[model samples]
Target: MDSGKARATPSFSAVRTKRAFEAVTDQIRTQLANGLLRQGDRLPAERELAEQFGLSRNTVREGLRALEVAGLVELKKGATGGAFIRRGQAEVVVSSFSDLYRLGAIRAEHLTEGRLIVGTAVTRLACQRATLEDIDLLQENVDDSAGSDAQTALSVNLDFHRLLARATSNPVLIVLTDALIGVQRELLKIYEPASQIDVIASRRRLLTHLRSRDEVAAVSEMEQHLRLLQSHYLEEDFRYRRRVAAEAKAAGEAASDEA
Candidate 1:
């Protein structure tokens, strides 16, 4: 045991140089992001990939495995399925937020606050810079949301916010808004499945303000809308905790009676 421990410590340091497989992985990732590789695009065969990268087959396999874990690619077992780049990654990002919520790392209130601040800021920019096309894109989302189910409404609402983020012309703001939107969508689904909020009307009001070139009104409307959504989550959490506390009290009384 003492000999094994001594050998492991040195072995870890000795292999500190860049791994061949990791280099290949980076190259593949860059290609994927650069449109050289796209969704449903089959990668070169394993043997060909190894030759092209000047790497061993084992190294290529390892890189593919890493990509699979990252949700960037899928590995199919049947002959029909071989490493396709994943499509519609919004679900993956949404699932990532689920894990954080499960761990209590982030909560509904935090996401709600993030949405309020970011939404208001983005609205101001959108009001100033929205093109005719931008307004049409947002109106399209609202039109789709009208009379749709909760799931469909949530998707369209997210699209509306994303359009607003794009109008800002800031890549950083767009990405950050997307992550915050993911969190807000998850919270809405969990806390307010059928909670009526007049979503279509609210969205229409916001767009109207923006179209009128009213930055102040746009920001005000956004903050109010996000706060309304926040209230739903807050009430849901309160009700859930109250229900749990009541159940515990009932259980305690039953136990005392049995004793």
Candidate 2:
């Protein structure tokens, strides 16, 4: 290749084979994906897994850690606790969405818009299909959030939204809502110190709409709530713009003075 010039063609070939731990992890993950192992199902003990895979105990441990981090398995101590398939999949979705945001593959606006659309659907369904039990649980979540700090309040708020998703009785909706709200919760952490919006009143109104089974009112209320959320990130944008402008002005002044 010429110096400082790109190659005419780059070689394309398969990557290296999976490491021992990766192979072990892949086997277990495949079972989970295939539904051969249900949630809460315990895997063989670490020693047994090592023997089964013909890998060392350390390798088996590494694979188990990978599964735990991937939200596929839970490892507990004591005689009763081993590697159990994860019961809740919300974290898995949350982890993926968080990664996308961190990688700049998705933006705040994209997620916010997603929440608006998906959240409205969940709210409408909750209004139409929520049983009395669902209503009561949502009421509990809202009530719990009333006196909490910003972080706890954020969790409570998402719980209410998750309830709305569940009231829809659609698993796909549940996962989608979980991922969106999880990202929102994380972003809110950055602004939590300055966040002062009293969510209780807004949430109470939404609950009332749901309880009344007023689909239109429920959706309208959700849209309004989402607009309120937009203000938080919009304020962030304004602050960031102001900081950049100040820095640019400083740089320009310095350059002119030097000249």
Candidate 3:
């Protein structure tokens, strides 16, 4: 027996007609969980899958589409293209979080709180695990924020957190940080920039603490910085609401005068 031989295709069983596509997905997922299928393995052709599952080709395609949307598989094009198992991506989580925010399931306050918790943990880990090169890259990020315009400064500042997350050397944390930051970016669009906050100075201080391997100080600095940012966001949101209300009132009065 060839121990290193790979399975060419998964053996799918017949599924009933009721919710047939879901059954198809469930079997594929089970194959994945059981190690019968692995990443980069090309699934059988649609006709073959349909026969195996005792379903129509359209049903099999629907199942594949669901898997693709869930980030479980990649559907490629051309004669060489088929449904191939794909590696997990951070964007899936980021998209899910962004959707939650859009549906009002995640509010600004929830996002800020989540950032504070994750940022502090990431900061502590970075202080312990960061290499000299990582620290240097972070320093460069901070330097780029200096004297930048509001938009440029925001971009650099966000990159600084991403760099810090990478310093942890943990893929899971990196994904989580990316997701939280992604949603926060959307929230930031509703309010004005953090022009009043001295972000560069705080980052500089955090960098010093990271270099010294002072986990306590680094975590403290990160928490304080996030709190200040949250305060600014809340104040800006209030001002934005008030301004909108005043504008509506003025518009209504002007229309009355015209009448």
TM-score of each: 0.65, 0.70, 0.88
Across residues 75-149, which tens digit of lDDT does each residue of candidate 3 receive? 999999999988768888999999999998987788888889899999999999999999999999887788677
Candidate 2 at 18: error in angstroms?
4.8
Q: Indicate the residue-level lDDT of 230 in model 3.
A: 86
Which candidate's TM-score is highest?
A: 3
Worst 10 residues of 1 by lDDT: 7-16
Q: Rate the local accuracy (lDDT) of all candidates.
A: 0.75, 0.78, 0.89
Tell me each candidate's RMSD, in Å, in order: 10.2, 12.0, 3.1
Instruction: Tell me which of candidates 1 and 3 scores higher on lDDT.
Output: 3
> Judged by TM-score relative to the true structure, which candidate is superior, 2 or 3?
3
Off by over 4 Å in 1: 1-56, 71-92, 144-155, 193-198, 248-259
Between candidates 1 and 2, the TM-score winner: 2
Query: Top model by lDDT, which number?
Result: 3
> In candidate 1, which residue pairs clash?
none
Kindly list the per-residue Cα lDDT of model 1 for residues 1-259, writing each as its tens digit.
Answer: 1222222111001112259777766777767665566676677677777777776788779989998877888888777767777764554555676668677788877777777888888999989998989998988888888868877877777788999999888766687788787776666655654343566778899989978998998898888888887787778877877888999999999999999
Task: Give the TM-score (vs. native) of candidate 1.
Answer: 0.65
Model 1 RMSD, rounded to 1 decimal: 10.2
Q: Candidate 2, overall lDDT?
A: 0.78
